[model samples]
Every structure is written in structure tokens, then in C-alpha cells.
Target: MSQPVAPKKLRVRGMILTGGVAAITIVGTRRSNITQKKEVIQDAHYEVDMISTLETRRAGLMQARQQWERKAKALQERIDGNKLRTIPGIGGTNGATDGSASSGK
Candidate 1:
């Protein structure tokens, strides 16, 4: 029993470490990259850069959540609320383009 428990504990600990690293890398590293990508040489430039950064962050977070929901759905196919939540473009009923508008339209 002890021998079997040791391997299970080790695997669980390893999974936790992997999840932590993935979370940090996905959010932290992408945030840093966005910071490096934006250049604010003028007032309008700063506003545009900041707005774009915010939008990117929003979209990234939404995508992450939707991915999580997809995984949840996969693991438990009968989760009720998510079935109605509509993840959009990734196996959910609604597409992401449903309410989007073009800049000049």
C-alpha cells in the first residue's frame, strides 16, 4: 500500500507543478510580451496601445476560460450550465463572430 501511495503522490505533485508552470508561462509571459510590443510615441499612440493591450488581455482571458470549459465538458459531458453558456468557436453553439463589428462599418 505504501509503495503504491508513493507513486500516486509523486504523480499528483508533478501534475501540480506542471499546472503552475503552465499558468505562469501562459499569462505572465504573454503579458510581458504585450508590454514589449506596444510603443507609445504620442498621446494617441499610448491610448491605442493601451486599448489594444486591454482588448488582447480580455480576449486571451476569455479564450483561456473557454478552453477550460471545453476541457470540463470533455471530462463531464453532462455539465448543465456550461451547455448553455456558449463558449463560441470552440465546440460551443455560438460562434465568436456573432456580435463583432468592423472598424469602418
Candidate 2:
């Protein structure tokens, strides 16, 4: 009976080297992908934090605007009241300019 043929050593070594290179390439690609994913996650977190901060600032600005408007309204009303008092026929002033009563001749 014929003997079984044996595999060549040089061919086996080449195949092993090719396989090692392929494995290294795959591992390197996966590592780069993982790094990119980590950066994306960090960016997303940063955006969320920034949005929250901006919203808080906006709310504060809105509240301040409302307070300012209320104060302005009150000031305008006071000015209008003073104007009415200064007018001749509004009944706001007694019309005694020098603390003396005028008599009609």
C-alpha cells in the first residue's frame, strides 16, 4: 500500500503567517471602531449637559423679564397718577397754590 503524503513545511509556515496578519488586521479594525463609538457617546453626553444648562438660563431670563415688565407697569401707572393729580379739573389737588384762599370780588 502507498504511504500517506505529508504536508510541506514552507507552505504551512506561509499559511500561518497569513493567518496571523489577518487576525491582527481584524483586531486593529475593531479597536478603532470601539474608540470611535466611545467618542460618539461622550459627545452625546456633552450635548445633553449643554442643552440642560441653556434651558435653565433661558428660564431664568424669562423670569427676569417678567419681573422687569411688572416693575415697568407699576412705574407707568404711578406716572399716570401724578399726571392726573397735576391736571386742573381731576380733583387730585386742592388748588391752593400759596397756602392762601382766594375770594371772589
Candidate 3:
């Protein structure tokens, strides 16, 4: 009878230890999943922010490109005007082949 009682007690203690181990494993897995989910959410937010920043920079570059194009066009117009002024007989009806007034005709 003494031997049988000792075996029963040992079985119960073993079952309790097994149950504790199972519970700890489950809790650890849950915490790891939660941490992984949080990391995924943070990564999603960072991606959106990065995309928005890139889009803003692209828009600014496009605006700067348009402004430079306009400046280039203005400069080209000034250069063309200077070219026309340098051409002889293109300024007026004056017979001066050079950029001076004619004495006779």
C-alpha cells in the first residue's frame, strides 16, 4: 500500500510539471506573434511614409524642371533677338550694310 501511494503522488507531480510547461510554451508563442504583428504594422507605416516622401520630391523636381524650361525659353528669345539685330539690312530700310546710318541712300 505504501508503494502504490508513492507512485500515485509522483504521477500527479509529473502531470503538473507537464501542464506548466505547456502553458509557458503557449504564452511565449502568443507573445512572439503579437510582437511580429506590431513589427508588420510599423513596417507598413514606414513604407507609406517613404512613398509619400518620394512622391513629394518627384513633384518638386517636375516643378523645377518646368521653371528651368521657361527660363531657357526666355534666354533663347533674347539670343534670337540679338541675332536679328546683328543681321545687316534686316533692321530697317537703311542702305548701311554695317550697323550705321547711310550718308546718301
Best by lDDT: 3
Every candidate's CA RMSD: 35.5, 5.8, 4.5
Please give the distance, in angstroms, between residue 43's alpha carbon in candidate 1 and its true position after superposition. Answer: 9.8
Error of 3 at 8 (Å): 1.3
Best by TM-score: 3
lDDT of 1: 0.80
Range of the 10 consecutive residues with the lowest summed lDDT in candidate 2: 1-10
Backbone clash count for every predicted candidate, in the order shown:
0, 0, 0
Overall lDDT per candidate, in order of appearance:
0.80, 0.85, 0.91
Q: What is the lDDT of candidate 2?
A: 0.85
lDDT of 3 by residue, 34-68 (tens): 99999999999999999999999999999999999
Better of 1 and 2 by TM-score: 2
CA lDDT of 62 in candidate 1?
100
Q: Cα miss at 21, model 3 (Å)?
A: 0.8
TM-scores of all models? 0.36, 0.73, 0.77
lDDT of 1 by residue, 1-105 (tens): 689999999999999999999999999989987776663346668889999999999999999999999998776866665667755565443454565634564
Per-residue lDDT of model 2, residues 1-105, tens digit only: 233323466677889999999999999999999999999999999999999999999999999999999999999999999876755443434665555656657
User: Judged by lDDT relative to the true structure, which candidate is superior, 1 or 2?
Assistant: 2
lDDT of 1 at 55: 100
